[model samples]
Target: MNESISDLTVRKHRGMWGWILISLLIAVIVLAVIGEIVVHRAMPILKGRVIETLSTRFNSRVEMEGFSVSVRKGLEVAGDGLRLYPQDEVVAAGATDPLITLGHFSFHASLSGLFVKPMHVGTVHVAGMAIHIPPREMRQQTPKGQRHLGKIKILVDEIVFDDSKLILGTIKPGKEPKDFELSRIVMRNVGPDAPWRYDATLVNAIPKGDIHAAGTFGPWNNESPGDSTVTGRYTFDHADLNTIKGIGGMLSSVGEFSGQLNRIVVDGTTETPDFSLDTANHPVPLHTKFHAIVDGTSGDTYLQPVEAQLGGSEFTCSGAVVNVKGKGHIIDLDVNVPAGRIQDFLQVAVKTTPVVMTGRLRMKTKLHIRPGPESVSKKIGLKGGFTLEQIHFTNPEVEDKVDMLSLRAQGDPKAAKPGAEDVHSEMVGEFVMDAGRLRFSKLNYSLPGADVMLAGEYTLDGERFEFEGKVRTKAKVSQMVASRWKSILLKPVDPFFKKDGAGAVIPVKVSGTKSAPKFGLDLHH
Candidate 1:
């Protein structure tokens, strides 16, 4: 009886152990199935949710392929590829119509935060990104009450673009549509949060050149609208200057350039943003700094009241606003050219000519123009002084090889106009030389045809000039003057000549404006 009871207890214990083992196996299988479902099905839905959230934030279409999620330890979401498109519609500031119509675009992201809320991005890579800005159509329909719509900002960790095209349109008068295309491009952001902290390189881009840029963006705050700053260095290698001559050519004289933007600040609440371009080793080497304030609330086109100092040359200009016609706003400007050497003046005047001189000159002028029009001034008022210590003409034909003359003059520097207000002006000045000599290799004064030696001090004013001092002539000079006068004019034109008909210097005076300055010789024996 005792043996039978013990056997029964043993059997019961064995049965309990078997049941426990079987339950453990069943739990394992269920958990495996659930894991498979989460990886194959639930993960993709979560990815779609992520894409939806980002699309809402950026106001653009987003998509991903081969998306997968991990849930063993932490939440990890990734995809083979992803993309994003430009917002369906974008309107530039101050424009009532949409300017950009984009196509579908995409990108990829590695997401984290399976256990935590507000998922974090471990690594986000964007690929096959292509954006299109459709050409402006005359009859296209746009959303009502929309001042402007477009991609104001784009954030991505890595982006790759292939065979991209862009079209720009001008509704204003006298402008043609423009387009740009690119073959391949690759861009990457180093930091995750500061996505604009980026390095991008483009090859076979429009304007025919390769471009490379790196910079950072954001930390936006309303208190300081310019708090969002971007600093980057870029190089445009082997670009065609003539292609963009209509725009950038006005400021620089280079076809190829590499430089850096040390700092660019855009204030959200301000009307103007401040920026600087550092151009080094370019053909022109332009270093310009600018400041502007823009109104954030109102989408009024902000014009940068540009005040720049270029290579010791300062310019103060305002009212560069853009008009409704898509043209630059006209502004009244004042420019002061400080006293500098004639060499510097020549550099600013004619770049190709090597005609060199040593002198100082100052000129003040006013400029008037409407935005988008060529710089044109209705009237230029100039009052300045120039002294040519030694004016030398390099042309060998002239007899005066070296001119040790000093000149001072001031006048309005505007060309004369017909049937308009008097655009002409006068200047009063003098040219003086002490103990100077001129050797004219060939000098033929039409009236006398004499090889003459001239030396004196002269005072000049509107249409009049006077020379007081001695003028000497060579021995043959007298005979030649007589012969030339007889040949040219049967009757002697001047009564100052004596019966001997000798060549001699008398009191001389010249008076005239630049257009009709006259020369007079007073021969008092």
Candidate 2:
């Protein structure tokens, strides 16, 4: 009887625990169904809250047609015919265009809100959008620390624009705005603590051209996008320069820059290598290396040190280039070359040298280029001088004549070949350019057999030259010429203008095309 009682009590305890477990399971199921109903009802309210918050925070008019909530996507929102405008702008009369237009937009919430630590926006996809940013001065302003967007305490991790157009007003007054269109651009890591990275191909809307860039931006604030820093590299290959206003011709350039934009002023250092400048006369572009401190505020780029290689010569140049809006451009540069070959002149200059020349050239040049057309180069103003020293002549006839004269004092005929006479002169000249012509003054050529002094004018574009001068010949050069019956031809004229100098002085006139010059020696100038 005692054993039967113990077994019945154990069975009763097991039956009681099983009933309790069943009751707990039923309660859990009921709660889950109720929770689902509540969430379904709350979604509509959640959508309104999002719309109100965004509209109030951005200080813009906002609306949405579709909204929902999901465990995976968090709060999902989509809409068409979306437009965002500043509050005052909508109230203002005659507003031409809204600041931004959104044909279709989508937004999803970040799941990290459960952790509630760092603020992150999952993503914002803006499709078929257009943004028109007006000129800096004309743009509407909200007092600092007072803008609704600035007051918001949320961070956005990413924003994307799909098939969007961006219109940016010029910093310069009276200049037209610039237009760029992009397809599905992605901008990520856009919080204050993180750097924003982006990649996109942008097309010029009006004058069609394309440029591609991939870069990082930092210190970005949502309210004031212009007040940010950028570190990036850009390349435009075989692009039309006219696509950007105020710049013309064809450009194929690559450059890198690191700068911050404060309002409309951009301050930074920039460098471009193998930049080609093409224009009307020059079908083949001229390549240059540009390194400078760029200042957008002052409308000037100051190049402390710049370099270029044209022909076989290397030039060190420094200057300031300024754009004067309606007046075009102003360029002031100082150019210097330490060592240059004279025969190399034909490689760069418009003229073909008359003689084979080898020399070391030193010059101090100040050149100013004004705004104009293709003739701008010819019309540039230049004030400078050059010294040609250690010059060698490869012409055999000229060398032999000058050598024989040099040997006159030594009375050496065996040295007639004039191997040592291959070179013997130092030529110097100072020039001033006005209009399209250069006037040469204080020009002197000191040679072994003769010294020639000249003054002349040369038309740069026409490649024409005219000069009047006197050549004073020494013992051998004068005696060699006087021995000819040609002396009889000048006997009547020699006495009228004859001069007692180092030897005989002859009046000469130089007139010809630079490519094929002519020297006339006669009593008449």
TM-score (all chains, Cα) for each model: 0.40, 0.62
Best by TM-score: 2
lDDT (Cα, tens digit) per residue for candidate 2, span 260-324:
43222222222222222221122222345666765433345677766655445566778877756
- Cα lDDT of model 1 by residue, 55-126, tens digit: 544444565556666756444555654554333432332223222222323333332333334443434433
Query: Candidate 1 regions off by >4 Å?
Result: 1-44, 55-122, 127-196, 201-211, 219-229, 233-240, 244-335, 341-358, 366-390, 396-525
Q: Write down the RMSD of candidate 1 (Cα, Å).
A: 15.7
Residue 105, candidate 2: Cα error in Å is 5.4
Worst 10 residues of 2 by lDDT: 275-284
